[model samples]
Target: MELKGIHHVSAITAKAKDNYHFYTEILGMRLVKKTINQDDPSVYHLFYADEAGNPGTDLTFFEIPNAGTTYQGKGSISGTSLRVPSDSALEFWEKRLSDYNVDHGGITRQGERNVINFRDPEGQRLTLISDETNQGVKGGRVWDHSSVPAEKGIIGLGPAKLTVQDPAPTVKVLTELLTFKQTGSYPSSFKGNEDIIVFETGEGGTGAEVHLEVRNDLPKERPGRGSVHHVAFRVDNEEELAQWRDRLQTARVPNSGLVDRFYFKSLYFREPNGILFELATDGPGFATDEDMNHLGESLALPPLFEHRREEIEANLKPLDI
Candidate 1:
Protein backbone atom coordinates (compact mmCIF):
# COMPACT_ATOMS: atom_id res chain seq x y z
CA MET A 1 0.00 0.00 0.00
CA GLU A 2 1.16 3.57 -0.70
CA LEU A 3 2.00 5.97 2.08
CA LYS A 4 0.21 9.29 2.47
CA GLY A 5 1.92 12.71 2.43
CA ILE A 6 3.92 14.24 5.28
CA HIS A 7 2.30 13.59 8.66
CA HIS A 8 4.38 15.99 10.73
CA VAL A 9 7.83 17.51 11.23
CA SER A 10 9.33 17.57 14.73
CA ALA A 11 12.06 20.03 15.71
CA ILE A 12 13.96 21.13 18.78
CA THR A 13 13.37 24.31 20.78
CA ALA A 14 15.25 25.50 23.86
CA LYS A 15 12.56 27.89 25.04
CA ALA A 16 9.08 26.42 25.35
CA LYS A 17 7.55 29.65 26.57
CA ASP A 18 8.86 31.75 23.73
CA ASN A 19 8.30 28.92 21.29
CA TYR A 20 4.66 28.68 22.31
CA HIS A 21 4.16 32.43 21.96
CA PHE A 22 5.86 32.59 18.58
CA TYR A 23 3.84 29.81 16.96
CA THR A 24 0.45 30.56 18.51
CA GLU A 25 0.66 34.35 18.62
CA ILE A 26 2.82 35.27 15.66
CA LEU A 27 2.36 32.47 13.18
CA GLY A 28 -1.27 32.06 14.24
CA MET A 29 -1.27 28.28 14.12
CA ARG A 30 -3.33 26.65 16.88
CA LEU A 31 -1.61 24.80 19.69
CA VAL A 32 -3.24 21.40 19.24
CA LYS A 33 -1.45 19.33 21.87
CA LYS A 34 0.69 20.08 24.91
CA THR A 35 2.60 17.05 26.14
CA ILE A 36 6.02 15.81 27.20
CA ASN A 37 8.48 13.99 24.94
CA GLN A 38 7.74 10.29 25.58
CA ASP A 39 11.36 9.21 25.20
CA ASP A 40 12.52 12.03 27.47
CA PRO A 41 9.72 12.81 29.88
CA SER A 42 11.58 15.73 31.43
CA VAL A 43 11.11 18.00 28.42
CA TYR A 44 8.00 19.43 26.73
CA HIS A 45 6.63 18.28 23.38
CA LEU A 46 4.40 20.85 21.76
CA PHE A 47 2.26 20.40 18.64
CA TYR A 48 0.83 23.19 16.53
CA ALA A 49 -1.53 22.69 13.62
CA ASP A 50 -4.88 23.56 12.06
CA GLU A 51 -8.03 23.69 14.18
CA ALA A 52 -8.39 19.92 14.25
CA GLY A 53 -4.72 18.95 14.35
CA ASN A 54 -5.08 16.84 11.21
CA PRO A 55 -2.42 14.30 10.29
CA GLY A 56 -0.69 16.42 7.65
CA THR A 57 -1.01 19.69 9.52
CA ASP A 58 1.21 19.17 12.56
CA LEU A 59 4.56 20.91 13.17
CA THR A 60 5.87 19.83 16.57
CA PHE A 61 8.70 20.91 18.88
CA PHE A 62 10.57 19.30 21.76
CA GLU A 63 11.87 21.63 24.45
CA ILE A 64 15.49 21.32 25.54
CA PRO A 65 16.44 24.04 27.96
CA ASN A 66 19.41 26.21 27.00
CA ALA A 67 20.35 24.15 23.97
CA GLY A 68 23.01 25.56 21.66
CA THR A 69 22.33 27.13 18.27
CA THR A 70 22.01 24.73 15.34
CA TYR A 71 24.93 24.71 12.89
CA GLN A 72 22.84 23.92 9.80
CA GLY A 73 24.42 21.79 7.11
CA LYS A 74 23.95 18.45 5.38
CA GLY A 75 22.23 15.20 6.51
CA SER A 76 19.29 17.14 7.89
CA ILE A 77 15.67 17.89 7.29
CA SER A 78 16.71 21.38 6.21
CA GLY A 79 13.37 23.16 5.99
CA THR A 80 9.68 22.56 6.87
CA SER A 81 6.90 24.23 4.93
CA LEU A 82 3.39 25.30 5.99
CA ARG A 83 0.67 25.54 3.37
CA VAL A 84 -1.34 28.71 3.04
CA PRO A 85 -4.42 29.21 0.84
CA SER A 86 -3.26 31.14 -2.19
CA ASP A 87 -0.50 33.29 -3.71
CA SER A 88 -2.07 36.39 -2.19
CA ALA A 89 -1.68 34.76 1.24
CA LEU A 90 2.07 35.08 0.70
CA GLU A 91 1.59 38.85 0.40
CA PHE A 92 -0.32 38.81 3.70
CA TRP A 93 2.35 36.73 5.45
CA GLU A 94 5.13 38.96 4.11
CA LYS A 95 3.44 41.94 5.72
CA ARG A 96 2.52 39.99 8.86
CA LEU A 97 6.01 38.58 9.38
CA SER A 98 7.46 42.07 9.00
CA ASP A 99 4.96 43.55 11.42
CA TYR A 100 5.97 40.92 13.95
CA ASN A 101 9.67 41.64 13.25
CA VAL A 102 10.29 38.04 12.18
CA ASP A 103 13.48 37.26 10.24
CA HIS A 104 12.65 36.23 6.69
CA GLY A 105 13.83 36.10 3.10
CA GLY A 106 10.93 37.66 1.20
CA ILE A 107 8.70 35.73 -1.17
CA THR A 108 10.35 33.98 -4.12
CA ARG A 109 9.41 31.28 -6.59
CA GLN A 110 10.55 27.78 -5.65
CA GLY A 111 9.84 25.15 -8.28
CA GLU A 112 6.30 25.97 -9.40
CA ARG A 113 4.94 27.81 -6.37
CA ASN A 114 5.69 31.09 -4.56
CA VAL A 115 7.23 30.49 -1.12
CA ILE A 116 8.43 32.67 1.72
CA ASN A 117 11.45 31.29 3.57
CA PHE A 118 11.81 32.38 7.16
CA ARG A 119 13.16 31.37 10.56
CA ASP A 120 11.42 31.10 13.90
CA PRO A 121 12.84 32.93 16.91
CA GLU A 122 14.98 29.88 17.64
CA GLY A 123 16.31 29.81 14.06
CA GLN A 124 13.98 27.00 12.96
CA ARG A 125 13.94 27.10 9.16
CA LEU A 126 10.37 27.35 7.81
CA THR A 127 8.60 28.21 4.58
CA LEU A 128 5.10 29.45 3.89
CA ILE A 129 4.10 27.80 0.60
CA SER A 130 1.12 29.04 -1.37
CA ASP A 131 -1.16 26.23 -2.55
CA GLU A 132 -2.55 28.41 -5.33
CA THR A 133 -1.52 25.88 -7.93
CA ASN A 134 -1.32 22.80 -5.68
CA GLN A 135 -3.11 19.59 -6.71
CA GLY A 136 -3.48 16.06 -5.21
CA VAL A 137 -3.60 15.82 -1.40
CA LYS A 138 -5.55 18.85 -0.21
CA GLY A 139 -4.71 20.90 2.89
CA GLY A 140 -6.56 21.04 6.23
CA ARG A 141 -9.03 23.63 7.38
CA VAL A 142 -7.90 26.91 9.01
CA TRP A 143 -8.49 27.62 12.70
CA ASP A 144 -11.37 30.03 12.93
CA HIS A 145 -9.93 31.55 16.09
CA SER A 146 -6.51 32.25 14.65
CA SER A 147 -5.22 35.82 14.82
CA VAL A 148 -4.62 35.53 11.09
CA PRO A 149 -7.91 35.62 9.18
CA ALA A 150 -9.37 32.30 8.08
CA GLU A 151 -8.64 33.13 4.44
CA LYS A 152 -5.00 33.92 5.16
CA GLY A 153 -4.26 31.41 7.94
CA ILE A 154 -1.85 28.53 7.47
CA ILE A 155 -3.83 25.46 6.35
CA GLY A 156 -1.56 22.39 6.38
CA LEU A 157 1.95 21.10 5.73
CA GLY A 158 3.74 21.25 2.40
CA PRO A 159 7.11 19.72 1.49
CA ALA A 160 9.81 18.92 4.05
CA LYS A 161 13.22 19.48 2.42
CA LEU A 162 16.07 17.03 2.94
CA THR A 163 19.57 18.40 2.49
CA VAL A 164 22.31 15.84 2.04
CA GLN A 165 25.82 15.47 0.57
CA ASP A 166 24.84 12.84 -2.01
CA PRO A 167 21.40 12.06 -3.32
CA ALA A 168 21.93 8.44 -4.46
CA PRO A 169 21.37 6.51 -1.24
CA THR A 170 18.79 8.88 0.14
CA VAL A 171 17.11 8.74 -3.25
CA LYS A 172 17.18 4.94 -3.12
CA VAL A 173 15.64 4.86 0.36
CA LEU A 174 12.85 7.16 -0.77
CA THR A 175 12.27 5.71 -4.22
CA GLU A 176 13.05 2.03 -3.73
CA LEU A 177 12.18 1.51 -0.06
CA LEU A 178 9.44 4.06 0.47
CA THR A 179 7.96 3.99 -3.02
CA PHE A 180 8.14 7.73 -3.69
CA LYS A 181 8.07 8.63 -7.39
CA GLN A 182 10.80 10.99 -8.55
CA THR A 183 8.63 13.68 -10.06
CA GLY A 184 11.14 16.23 -11.33
CA SER A 185 14.17 18.42 -10.57
CA TYR A 186 14.58 22.14 -10.07
CA PRO A 187 17.56 24.48 -10.51
CA SER A 188 19.53 24.99 -7.34
CA SER A 189 19.52 28.40 -5.74
CA PHE A 190 23.04 27.63 -4.53
CA LYS A 191 25.74 28.20 -7.08
CA GLY A 192 27.83 25.15 -8.14
CA ASN A 193 25.31 22.69 -6.70
CA GLU A 194 23.20 20.14 -8.59
CA ASP A 195 19.54 20.76 -9.28
CA ILE A 196 17.22 19.68 -6.45
CA ILE A 197 15.23 16.51 -7.13
CA VAL A 198 11.51 16.17 -6.40
CA PHE A 199 9.87 12.99 -5.02
CA GLU A 200 6.15 12.44 -4.64
CA THR A 201 3.83 9.94 -2.94
CA GLY A 202 0.05 9.58 -2.29
CA GLU A 203 -1.99 11.96 -4.42
CA GLY A 204 1.23 13.86 -5.30
CA GLY A 205 1.33 17.63 -4.99
CA THR A 206 2.92 20.28 -2.78
CA GLY A 207 1.39 18.57 0.25
CA ALA A 208 2.77 15.17 -0.72
CA GLU A 209 6.27 15.79 -1.97
CA VAL A 210 9.87 15.88 -0.76
CA HIS A 211 12.39 18.27 -2.31
CA LEU A 212 15.95 16.90 -2.16
CA GLU A 213 18.86 19.32 -2.41
CA VAL A 214 22.46 18.14 -2.70
CA ARG A 215 24.92 20.35 -0.87
CA ASN A 216 28.47 19.01 -0.71
CA ASP A 217 29.67 22.28 0.78
CA LEU A 218 27.95 22.28 4.20
CA PRO A 219 29.08 20.29 7.23
CA LYS A 220 26.97 17.60 8.94
CA GLU A 221 24.35 19.31 11.11
CA ARG A 222 24.98 19.77 14.83
CA PRO A 223 21.49 19.93 16.26
CA GLY A 224 20.53 22.15 19.18
CA ARG A 225 17.72 24.65 19.62
CA GLY A 226 16.28 24.80 16.14
CA SER A 227 17.32 21.56 14.46
CA VAL A 228 14.73 19.23 13.02
CA HIS A 229 14.66 15.96 14.96
CA HIS A 230 12.79 13.91 12.36
CA VAL A 231 10.15 13.95 9.65
CA ALA A 232 7.24 11.44 9.66
CA PHE A 233 5.24 10.24 6.67
CA ARG A 234 1.59 9.22 7.08
CA VAL A 235 0.27 5.67 6.87
CA ASP A 236 -3.45 4.82 6.90
CA ASN A 237 -3.73 2.47 9.91
CA GLU A 238 -2.18 -0.13 12.25
CA GLU A 239 -2.66 -3.18 10.02
CA GLU A 240 -0.89 -1.39 7.20
CA LEU A 241 1.73 -0.19 9.68
CA ALA A 242 2.37 -3.84 10.65
CA GLN A 243 2.82 -4.78 7.01
CA TRP A 244 5.28 -1.90 6.66
CA ARG A 245 7.20 -3.25 9.64
CA ASP A 246 7.45 -6.58 7.81
CA ARG A 247 8.51 -4.82 4.62
CA LEU A 248 11.31 -2.94 6.41
CA GLN A 249 12.48 -6.25 7.85
CA THR A 250 12.47 -7.89 4.43
CA ALA A 251 14.48 -4.97 3.02
CA ARG A 252 16.93 -5.26 5.94
CA VAL A 253 16.36 -1.67 7.02
CA PRO A 254 16.54 -1.38 10.80
CA ASN A 255 13.56 0.33 12.38
CA SER A 256 12.07 1.10 15.80
CA GLY A 257 9.52 -1.65 15.27
CA LEU A 258 5.98 -0.60 16.12
CA VAL A 259 5.54 2.17 18.68
CA ASP A 260 2.36 3.44 20.29
CA ARG A 261 2.66 7.23 20.51
CA PHE A 262 -0.89 7.30 22.04
CA TYR A 263 -2.05 9.70 19.39
CA PHE A 264 -0.54 7.62 16.63
CA LYS A 265 1.31 4.36 15.93
CA SER A 266 4.78 4.75 14.42
CA LEU A 267 7.80 3.02 12.93
CA TYR A 268 11.00 5.09 12.96
CA PHE A 269 14.07 4.40 10.85
CA ARG A 270 16.95 6.44 9.58
CA GLU A 271 18.08 6.45 5.98
CA PRO A 272 21.62 5.61 4.83
CA ASN A 273 22.53 9.30 5.25
CA GLY A 274 21.42 9.22 8.93
CA ILE A 275 18.43 11.53 8.62
CA LEU A 276 15.54 10.26 10.80
CA PHE A 277 12.33 9.16 9.09
CA GLU A 278 9.12 7.83 10.66
CA LEU A 279 6.15 6.06 9.17
CA ALA A 280 3.15 6.94 11.36
CA THR A 281 -0.52 5.92 11.35
CA ASP A 282 -3.16 8.67 11.38
CA GLY A 283 -5.60 7.59 14.07
CA PRO A 284 -6.53 8.21 17.73
CA GLY A 285 -5.60 11.82 17.05
CA PHE A 286 -5.05 14.77 19.39
CA ALA A 287 -8.67 14.84 20.54
CA THR A 288 -8.29 11.45 22.18
CA ASP A 289 -7.85 13.05 25.60
CA GLU A 290 -8.69 16.71 25.22
CA ASP A 291 -11.88 18.45 24.17
CA MET A 292 -11.51 19.91 20.69
CA ASN A 293 -12.61 23.37 21.77
CA HIS A 294 -10.01 23.55 24.53
CA LEU A 295 -7.06 21.66 23.14
CA GLY A 296 -3.62 22.66 24.48
CA GLU A 297 -5.24 24.45 27.44
CA SER A 298 -3.56 21.97 29.78
CA LEU A 299 -1.00 19.19 29.64
CA ALA A 300 -1.86 15.87 27.96
CA LEU A 301 -0.13 12.60 28.73
CA PRO A 302 -0.42 9.25 27.02
CA PRO A 303 -2.37 6.51 28.86
CA LEU A 304 0.81 4.73 29.87
CA PHE A 305 2.27 7.99 31.10
CA GLU A 306 -0.92 8.99 32.88
CA HIS A 307 0.17 7.20 36.06
CA ARG A 308 3.19 9.51 36.36
CA ARG A 309 1.44 12.73 35.32
CA GLU A 310 2.09 14.45 38.62
CA GLU A 311 5.80 13.69 38.52
CA ILE A 312 6.02 14.68 34.88
CA GLU A 313 4.15 17.92 35.46
CA ALA A 314 6.41 18.79 38.38
CA ASN A 315 9.54 18.45 36.24
CA LEU A 316 8.30 20.67 33.40
CA LYS A 317 8.60 24.42 33.74
CA PRO A 318 5.20 26.12 33.70
CA LEU A 319 4.64 27.23 30.11
CA ASP A 320 3.05 30.68 29.64
CA ILE A 321 1.17 29.88 26.43
Candidate 2:
Protein backbone atom coordinates (compact mmCIF):
# COMPACT_ATOMS: atom_id res chain seq x y z
CA MET A 1 0.00 0.00 0.00
CA GLU A 2 1.18 3.57 -0.62
CA LEU A 3 1.33 5.77 2.52
CA LYS A 4 1.47 9.54 1.97
CA GLY A 5 4.02 10.59 4.62
CA ILE A 6 4.14 11.30 8.37
CA HIS A 7 1.17 12.58 10.31
CA HIS A 8 1.60 14.02 13.81
CA VAL A 9 3.65 12.30 16.52
CA SER A 10 1.92 11.91 19.88
CA ALA A 11 3.43 11.56 23.34
CA ILE A 12 2.39 11.51 27.00
CA THR A 13 3.15 14.35 29.38
CA ALA A 14 3.08 14.43 33.18
CA LYS A 15 1.62 17.91 33.47
CA ALA A 16 -0.43 19.89 30.99
CA LYS A 17 1.07 23.26 31.85
CA ASP A 18 4.67 22.22 31.42
CA ASN A 19 3.91 20.54 28.13
CA TYR A 20 2.16 23.68 26.96
CA HIS A 21 4.99 25.98 27.94
CA PHE A 22 7.77 23.85 26.49
CA TYR A 23 6.20 23.31 23.09
CA THR A 24 5.05 26.91 22.75
CA GLU A 25 7.19 29.38 24.70
CA ILE A 26 10.47 27.53 24.47
CA LEU A 27 10.19 25.69 21.18
CA GLY A 28 8.51 28.66 19.48
CA MET A 29 5.70 26.48 18.17
CA ARG A 30 2.19 27.85 17.99
CA LEU A 31 -0.35 26.26 20.32
CA VAL A 32 -2.45 25.20 17.37
CA LYS A 33 -5.32 23.81 19.40
CA LYS A 34 -6.51 23.20 22.93
CA THR A 35 -8.84 20.27 23.40
CA ILE A 36 -9.45 17.45 25.85
CA ASN A 37 -8.38 13.88 25.31
CA GLN A 38 -11.37 12.11 23.79
CA ASP A 39 -10.52 8.87 25.57
CA ASP A 40 -10.25 10.65 28.91
CA PRO A 41 -12.01 13.98 29.12
CA SER A 42 -10.51 14.87 32.51
CA VAL A 43 -7.13 15.29 30.84
CA TYR A 44 -6.08 17.69 28.12
CA HIS A 45 -4.80 16.90 24.65
CA LEU A 46 -2.58 19.62 23.29
CA PHE A 47 -1.28 20.08 19.76
CA TYR A 48 1.75 22.21 18.90
CA ALA A 49 2.62 22.95 15.32
CA ASP A 50 2.88 25.65 12.69
CA GLU A 51 0.09 28.22 12.41
CA ALA A 52 -1.84 26.04 10.02
CA GLY A 53 -1.75 23.11 12.42
CA ASN A 54 -1.12 20.78 9.50
CA PRO A 55 -0.83 17.08 10.21
CA GLY A 56 2.91 16.55 9.74
CA THR A 57 3.70 19.86 11.39
CA ASP A 58 2.23 18.78 14.73
CA LEU A 59 3.74 17.38 17.92
CA THR A 60 0.95 16.33 20.25
CA PHE A 61 0.75 15.36 23.92
CA PHE A 62 -1.80 13.81 26.25
CA GLU A 63 -1.78 14.97 29.85
CA ILE A 64 -1.40 12.03 32.26
CA PRO A 65 -1.02 13.72 35.61
CA ASN A 66 -0.63 10.79 37.98
CA ALA A 67 1.69 8.50 36.05
CA GLY A 68 4.93 7.91 37.91
CA THR A 69 8.18 9.35 36.62
CA THR A 70 9.40 7.52 33.55
CA TYR A 71 12.78 5.95 33.27
CA GLN A 72 14.52 6.16 29.92
CA GLY A 73 14.66 2.56 28.73
CA LYS A 74 15.02 0.59 25.55
CA GLY A 75 12.00 -0.16 23.30
CA SER A 76 10.64 3.38 23.67
CA ILE A 77 11.03 6.42 21.45
CA SER A 78 14.49 7.82 22.08
CA GLY A 79 14.41 11.40 20.86
CA THR A 80 12.61 13.76 18.49
CA SER A 81 14.59 16.02 16.12
CA LEU A 82 13.34 19.14 14.30
CA ARG A 83 14.93 20.62 11.20
CA VAL A 84 15.43 24.36 10.42
CA PRO A 85 16.57 26.24 7.36
CA SER A 86 20.23 26.67 8.24
CA ASP A 87 22.78 26.77 11.04
CA SER A 88 22.05 30.48 11.48
CA ALA A 89 18.68 29.59 13.00
CA LEU A 90 20.62 27.78 15.70
CA GLU A 91 22.02 31.11 16.87
CA PHE A 92 18.52 32.48 17.28
CA TRP A 93 17.49 29.33 19.21
CA GLU A 94 20.62 29.40 21.37
CA LYS A 95 20.00 32.98 22.36
CA ARG A 96 16.31 32.32 22.78
CA LEU A 97 16.96 29.42 25.13
CA SER A 98 19.46 31.43 27.10
CA ASP A 99 17.04 34.33 27.45
CA TYR A 100 14.50 31.95 28.88
CA ASN A 101 17.03 30.42 31.29
CA VAL A 102 16.59 27.07 29.57
CA ASP A 103 19.76 25.02 29.51
CA HIS A 104 21.04 23.42 26.28
CA GLY A 105 24.23 21.96 24.92
CA GLY A 106 26.64 23.46 22.45
CA ILE A 107 26.42 22.97 18.71
CA THR A 108 27.80 19.82 17.15
CA ARG A 109 28.20 18.87 13.52
CA GLN A 110 26.65 15.66 12.23
CA GLY A 111 26.78 14.46 8.68
CA GLU A 112 26.85 17.63 6.57
CA ARG A 113 24.88 19.81 9.02
CA ASN A 114 25.39 21.52 12.38
CA VAL A 115 22.92 20.65 15.15
CA ILE A 116 22.19 22.12 18.56
CA ASN A 117 20.77 19.78 21.18
CA PHE A 118 18.41 20.82 23.95
CA ARG A 119 15.85 19.33 26.31
CA ASP A 120 12.28 20.33 26.94
CA PRO A 121 10.97 21.07 30.43
CA GLU A 122 10.11 17.36 30.48
CA GLY A 123 13.59 16.31 29.44
CA GLN A 124 12.74 15.15 25.94
CA ARG A 125 15.86 15.52 23.79
CA LEU A 126 15.28 17.89 20.87
CA THR A 127 17.61 19.22 18.23
CA LEU A 128 17.64 22.12 15.80
CA ILE A 129 19.66 21.73 12.64
CA SER A 130 20.34 24.02 9.70
CA ASP A 131 19.77 22.35 6.37
CA GLU A 132 18.84 25.12 3.89
CA THR A 133 19.53 22.79 1.00
CA ASN A 134 16.31 20.96 1.91
CA GLN A 135 13.71 23.76 1.72
CA GLY A 136 10.61 23.56 -0.55
CA VAL A 137 11.55 19.99 -1.45
CA LYS A 138 8.78 18.97 0.96
CA GLY A 139 5.48 20.79 1.36
CA GLY A 140 5.02 22.37 4.82
CA ARG A 141 2.05 23.97 6.51
CA VAL A 142 2.67 27.69 6.69
CA TRP A 143 2.83 29.63 10.01
CA ASP A 144 2.98 33.44 9.62
CA HIS A 145 3.31 34.45 13.25
CA SER A 146 5.23 37.57 14.23
CA SER A 147 7.01 35.61 16.98
CA VAL A 148 8.22 33.04 14.45
CA PRO A 149 9.69 35.11 11.68
CA ALA A 150 8.77 33.49 8.38
CA GLU A 151 12.38 32.69 7.52
CA LYS A 152 13.65 31.19 10.80
CA GLY A 153 10.43 29.49 11.84
CA ILE A 154 10.32 25.73 11.62
CA ILE A 155 9.67 24.57 8.09
CA GLY A 156 8.34 21.19 9.26
CA LEU A 157 9.19 17.97 11.04
CA GLY A 158 12.48 16.11 10.84
CA PRO A 159 13.08 12.41 11.55
CA ALA A 160 12.03 10.89 14.90
CA LYS A 161 14.77 8.53 16.15
CA LEU A 162 13.71 5.27 17.76
CA THR A 163 15.92 3.16 20.00
CA VAL A 164 14.91 -0.47 19.77
CA GLN A 165 16.14 -3.75 21.23
CA ASP A 166 16.43 -5.43 17.87
CA PRO A 167 16.43 -3.96 14.37
CA ALA A 168 15.29 -6.82 12.15
CA PRO A 169 11.49 -6.83 12.56
CA THR A 170 11.28 -3.05 12.72
CA VAL A 171 13.51 -2.89 9.67
CA LYS A 172 11.19 -5.23 7.79
CA VAL A 173 8.11 -3.16 8.66
CA LEU A 174 9.86 0.06 7.65
CA THR A 175 11.12 -1.28 4.34
CA GLU A 176 8.20 -3.46 3.30
CA LEU A 177 5.08 -1.93 4.90
CA LEU A 178 5.93 1.72 5.48
CA THR A 179 7.71 2.18 2.12
CA PHE A 180 10.86 3.70 3.64
CA LYS A 181 14.06 3.40 1.66
CA GLN A 182 17.28 2.43 3.42
CA THR A 183 19.53 5.48 3.57
CA GLY A 184 22.42 3.60 5.24
CA SER A 185 23.84 3.91 8.78
CA TYR A 186 26.14 6.22 10.66
CA PRO A 187 28.07 6.13 13.95
CA SER A 188 26.14 7.84 16.73
CA SER A 189 27.49 10.90 18.53
CA PHE A 190 25.32 10.26 21.59
CA LYS A 191 26.26 7.98 24.50
CA GLY A 192 26.71 4.18 24.36
CA ASN A 193 25.40 4.00 20.82
CA GLU A 194 27.02 2.58 17.73
CA ASP A 195 25.44 2.59 14.27
CA ILE A 196 22.18 4.34 13.35
CA ILE A 197 19.90 3.38 10.46
CA VAL A 198 18.46 6.19 8.36
CA PHE A 199 15.25 5.85 6.33
CA GLU A 200 13.97 8.51 3.97
CA THR A 201 10.68 9.22 2.25
CA GLY A 202 10.57 11.00 -1.09
CA GLU A 203 10.18 14.15 1.04
CA GLY A 204 13.49 15.05 2.66
CA GLY A 205 13.26 16.98 5.93
CA THR A 206 11.80 16.32 9.38
CA GLY A 207 8.96 14.09 8.26
CA ALA A 208 11.07 12.84 5.40
CA GLU A 209 13.70 10.67 7.09
CA VAL A 210 13.46 8.64 10.31
CA HIS A 211 16.55 7.32 12.06
CA LEU A 212 16.47 4.07 14.06
CA GLU A 213 19.23 3.03 16.43
CA VAL A 214 19.51 -0.46 17.85
CA ARG A 215 21.14 -0.63 21.26
CA ASN A 216 21.22 -3.97 23.02
CA ASP A 217 23.02 -2.56 26.03
CA LEU A 218 20.50 0.07 27.19
CA PRO A 219 17.54 -1.00 29.33
CA LYS A 220 14.08 -0.90 27.76
CA GLU A 221 12.41 2.53 27.85
CA ARG A 222 9.42 3.29 30.03
CA PRO A 223 6.73 5.70 28.80
CA GLY A 224 6.64 9.10 30.49
CA ARG A 225 8.60 12.31 30.21
CA GLY A 226 11.18 12.20 27.41
CA SER A 227 9.46 9.24 25.75
CA VAL A 228 7.61 9.23 22.45
CA HIS A 229 4.15 7.72 22.72
CA HIS A 230 3.70 6.87 19.05
CA VAL A 231 4.78 8.03 15.64
CA ALA A 232 2.02 8.67 13.07
CA PHE A 233 2.23 8.55 9.28
CA ARG A 234 -0.08 10.49 6.96
CA VAL A 235 -2.71 8.95 4.69
CA ASP A 236 -4.88 10.76 2.18
CA ASN A 237 -8.29 9.55 3.37
CA GLU A 238 -10.32 6.82 5.01
CA GLU A 239 -10.30 4.66 1.88
CA GLU A 240 -6.49 4.71 1.78
CA LEU A 241 -6.28 4.21 5.55
CA ALA A 242 -8.55 1.16 5.23
CA GLN A 243 -6.19 -0.28 2.67
CA TRP A 244 -3.30 0.22 5.12
CA ARG A 245 -5.28 -1.39 7.92
CA ASP A 246 -5.87 -4.39 5.72
CA ARG A 247 -2.19 -4.53 4.90
CA LEU A 248 -1.27 -4.53 8.57
CA GLN A 249 -3.80 -7.29 9.24
CA THR A 250 -2.31 -9.35 6.42
CA ALA A 251 1.15 -8.98 7.95
CA ARG A 252 -0.31 -10.02 11.31
CA VAL A 253 0.59 -6.67 12.81
CA PRO A 254 -1.52 -6.18 15.92
CA ASN A 255 -3.48 -2.93 15.98
CA SER A 256 -5.95 -1.05 18.10
CA GLY A 257 -9.36 -0.82 16.50
CA LEU A 258 -9.80 2.16 14.23
CA VAL A 259 -10.31 5.41 16.18
CA ASP A 260 -11.76 8.71 15.03
CA ARG A 261 -9.60 11.67 16.15
CA PHE A 262 -12.06 14.29 14.85
CA TYR A 263 -9.62 16.21 12.70
CA PHE A 264 -8.21 12.90 11.56
CA LYS A 265 -8.88 9.17 11.89
CA SER A 266 -6.24 6.91 13.42
CA LEU A 267 -5.14 3.28 13.77
CA TYR A 268 -2.62 2.36 16.46
CA PHE A 269 -0.33 -0.66 16.37
CA ARG A 270 3.04 -1.80 17.56
CA GLU A 271 5.79 -2.53 15.10
CA PRO A 272 7.57 -5.87 15.35
CA ASN A 273 10.29 -4.26 17.43
CA GLY A 274 7.63 -2.87 19.85
CA ILE A 275 7.71 0.86 19.07
CA LEU A 276 4.14 2.17 18.85
CA PHE A 277 3.04 3.19 15.35
CA GLU A 278 0.00 5.10 14.16
CA LEU A 279 -1.59 5.49 10.75
CA ALA A 280 -3.54 8.79 10.65
CA THR A 281 -5.64 10.44 7.96
CA ASP A 282 -4.65 13.95 6.91
CA GLY A 283 -8.09 15.60 6.84
CA PRO A 284 -10.79 16.96 7.37
CA GLY A 285 -8.18 18.86 9.31
CA PHE A 286 -7.65 21.61 11.88
CA ALA A 287 -9.95 23.88 9.95
CA THR A 288 -12.86 21.85 11.30
CA ASP A 289 -13.40 24.06 14.32
CA GLU A 290 -11.89 27.56 14.09
CA ASP A 291 -11.25 29.03 10.68
CA MET A 292 -7.71 28.39 9.37
CA ASN A 293 -6.90 32.03 10.13
CA HIS A 294 -7.90 31.73 13.81
CA LEU A 295 -6.79 28.16 14.62
CA GLY A 296 -4.92 27.51 17.88
CA GLU A 297 -5.88 30.82 19.46
CA SER A 298 -8.43 29.39 21.88
CA LEU A 299 -10.13 26.14 22.82
CA ALA A 300 -11.10 24.20 19.70
CA LEU A 301 -13.08 21.04 20.05
CA PRO A 302 -14.66 18.40 17.90
CA PRO A 303 -18.43 18.36 17.58
CA LEU A 304 -18.48 15.66 20.25
CA PHE A 305 -16.87 18.05 22.72
CA GLU A 306 -18.58 21.21 21.59
CA HIS A 307 -21.42 20.58 24.03
CA ARG A 308 -18.93 20.22 26.89
CA ARG A 309 -16.82 23.24 25.91
CA GLU A 310 -17.60 25.20 29.07
CA GLU A 311 -16.76 22.24 31.33
CA ILE A 312 -13.64 21.33 29.38
CA GLU A 313 -12.38 24.86 29.39
CA ALA A 314 -13.02 25.18 33.12
CA ASN A 315 -11.11 22.01 33.86
CA LEU A 316 -8.09 22.82 31.71
CA LYS A 317 -5.43 25.10 33.15
CA PRO A 318 -5.29 28.48 31.45
CA LEU A 319 -2.62 28.73 28.77
CA ASP A 320 -1.30 31.59 26.69
CA ILE A 321 -1.67 30.51 23.10
lDDT of 2: 0.76
Q: What is the Cα-based lDDT of residue 210 in candidate 2? A: 73
Off by over 4 Å in 2: 135-142, 190-192
Per-residue lDDT of candidate 1, residues 194-225 (tens digit) = 99899999999888999999998999999999
* lDDT comparing candidate 1 with the true structure: 0.93
Clash pairs, candidate 1, are none
lDDT tens digits by residue: candidate 2, 148-234 = 666676756677788887888888888888888887677787676777888876554546677888777778776776567888887
Which candidate number would show the highest TM-score if scored against the true structure?
Answer: 1
Q: Against the true structure, what is every candidate's RMSD? A: 0.9, 2.1
> Best candidate, lDDT-wise?
1
- Per-model TM-score versus the true fold: 0.98, 0.92
Worst 10 contiguous positions by lDDT, candidate 2: 133-142
User: What C-alpha root-mean-square deviation, in Å, does candidate 1 show against the real structure?
Assistant: 0.9
